[model samples]
Target: MTRAFLLAATACLISQAAFAHAFLDRASPAVGSEVAGSPPALDLTYTEPVEPLFSTIQVTDASGGRVDQGTPKPLDGGHVLSVALKPLLPGVYTVEWHVTSVDTHKTEGHFTFTVKR
Candidate 1:
């Protein structure tokens, strides 16, 4: 019984590792950059390929109000997501994302950036 339990625990750990979702590898306009002008668009790159249909990016203003008007688009590699931003006012903004990898595992995270007038 002890042997069986150990085997089960090992299997569980392996399964969890294998099904882990992709994490943010990098972003353009970066996580905390203060830019002089409005960024033409937002870019996010992940550690692994993500399911385009199951991924989303949401942009919000400093007051926590949603500011993005349209859906995000998947780049060719399937690991990058791009979203067009409206002409933003000088303020802080947060980008929240949720992505499900091709393996069907889900993960989510958020980051912030600021715009200068």
Candidate 2:
């Protein structure tokens, strides 16, 4: 009975890891980085492929004004998300993202990057 319990526990742990929520793996312009100039767009990479239909990315300046051009677009089979940006002035920009992985797990996060004067 003890052996069966241990096996069941192990299987539970394995399943949890296998169906883990998707998280940010990387970002273009690099998270918390200062760029010499404005990037025309933003790229976000995730640990797993996400469902674009249920995912979102929003960008805002320090003043809380939305700067992202419009809806986010998924690329690279949904592992990467790209969003267009309006002309950015020298300042801090915050990017907020929420994604639902193909596995049906959902997660969200935010980061900031700066443009040099």
The TM-scores, one per candidate, come to: 0.80, 0.87
lDDT of all predictions, in order shown?
A: 0.88, 0.93
Off by over 4 Å in 2: 1-19
Across 30-90, the per-residue lDDT of candidate 1 in tens digits comes to: 9998989888788899888898798899999988888776877888588898889888899
- Tens digit of per-residue lDDT, candidate 2, span 1-117: 999999999999998886688899999979999999889999999999999889999999999999999788889998999999999999999999999999899999999999999
Top candidate on TM-score is 2
Q: Give the TM-score of candidate 1.
A: 0.80
